[model samples]
Target: MTTLGLIGSGHIGSQLARAAVAHGYDVLVSNSRGPDSLSELILELGERATAGTTADAATADLVAVAIPLKDVQNIPADLLGGKIVIDTSNYYPRRDGTIAPLDAGEMTVSEFVQAHFADARLVKAFNHIQAPAITDDAQSAGTAERRALIVAGDDDDAKKIVSGFIDAIGFDVLDIGPLSASWRIEAGTPAFGPRRDREELEIDIAQATRSARH
Candidate 1:
């Protein structure tokens, strides 16, 4: 059985943990507040779920990062090195403060995160959807109009792994090229929110345009 580690048990993280457990994956969830703070969540997740330190979670088969963008620096690099990390974070200047590259439209949020965990096989996902929609809107594979989630990463194998996980959890996967091109689904883009199938998502991606940094 695959172990899914979560590095932040906030809205998105908790939802992902639920989805993972529902699909028979053991989940290790952790947050900045410490394992004791996650006891309730673990109990709710049942026997398959365990609360652990961030480092402990990082050691799982796959790790999902659901923390605020500003705190990416706080993630332990040494432990996450060479791991497949699903980055479920978005950049909001108001909350994360202004980043030069992001403000200049030079690098997508995923690129910036990749730079921080240089050795991790990071795939940008779960960032474009709402927290509640992660499980609520999921549909089985082959279901007509099944919601599609976008994934962008520099590593082909890493993207494939994450895509499979998405499919298993009841959604379709849409690969939107590399991490550099992930701006198409960033917060301001048309593809960011809403539940769209593959075809509709493709159209939204095509219509995405970067507004002036200001």
Candidate 2:
């Protein structure tokens, strides 16, 4: 079983932790508030789940970064080294304040994350979709049809590792190439949060072929 680590205890982080626990993965959750503060959530998640400091969570086989985009730099560089770090953040100028380059379409959110967490195996995923939808694994298993999630990373092995986790959570995985091509999955793109069926998602991605902003 994968020992999952979460580096934020916000909505997405907390919900994803529950899903991971439900799927039988051992989870270590953390936040900026300190490990002791997460004791209540840790207790709710049961024995399979535990709370730890940010650095401790980052040391897992796979780490999910669910922090606000602006605060991502606070994550220690050494902590993320050589590990798969899942990015589940979005650029919300009002709440997170403006990121000039991101607002200008000069850099994708994932690219910014990679630049900050340079040593980590960064994968652009779980960003376009909403956390509520992500929590609903049953949405992926029903006959009514569910959408595929985009995953972009330079490393093939890391992408596969993340894809396996995606599959375990009941969603289809769409390989959108490397990190440089992540603009295709960023917010404001047509593909972002489109809960269409798998075939629809593929076609949507294929048809609107604009050059992704570097």
Candidate 3:
């Protein structure tokens, strides 16, 4: 995708916008407060970036749902139909309260988001990352100590596209299988840390166990 669209301008969303711009993708960033509220971030992102409504941003080539896990339903599905959506949210009961089904392990957080945006191709990413670490730790693609990010989705083509974006934004990618398998990298897993290198992540993903409970 030539343009990266963000539905939230918090830590993860802001960093993604900066990284996307640096990597040659124009970005449209939005927050619940509206475009006027994003003035500073737009200036920080420079010429390639613009502030728009959630709907406007959602219309771009690819969209990242970087809002809180409880807020996914607020994004209109009409704008996401047939689009490749990157889901960057993690469920923290202390923050998002108890999403019973998710807490019970009936489905991964990404699958829950997929149900909210049924027509969109949802790929889970950026959920386990800490933005401060991303800013300090990014390594060029093949650097020996480059860190890795896992993308989980059922759509191969959609996963391929998201993987390219991850590589461009300065990280390696490991397809940790489908969304059904995403709990392996969820908040409590080994792959969910703030300081893991590629080698470390390889071990983490491999050692990931099936937990029917998050």
Candidate 3, superposed: residue stretches over 4 Å from native:
none
Q: How do the predictions measure up, each by TM-score?
A: 0.97, 0.90, 0.96
Between candidates 1 and 2, name the one with more favorable TM-score.
1
Tens-digit lDDT string for candidate 2 (52-145): 9988897788999999987998777677888898988787787788787777667778888888888888888888777777766435455466
The lDDT, on a scale of 0 to 1, for candidate 1 is 0.92
Poorly placed runs, candidate 2 (over 4 Å): 139-144, 207-214
Error of 2 at 26 (Å): 0.3
Residue 68's lDDT in candidate 1? 98
Candidate 1: residue 159 Cα off by (Å):
0.4
CA lDDT of each candidate?
0.92, 0.81, 0.88
What value of lDDT does candidate 2 attain over all alpha carbons?
0.81
Q: Give candidates' CA RMSD values in order.
A: 1.2, 2.4, 1.2
lDDT of 3 at 43: 90
Instruction: Give stretches of model 1 more than 4 Å off.
Output: 212-214
Stretch of 10 with least lDDT, candidate 3? 205-214
How much does candidate 1 score in TM-score?
A: 0.97
Candidate with maximal lDDT: 1
Clashes in model 3: which pairs?
Answer: none
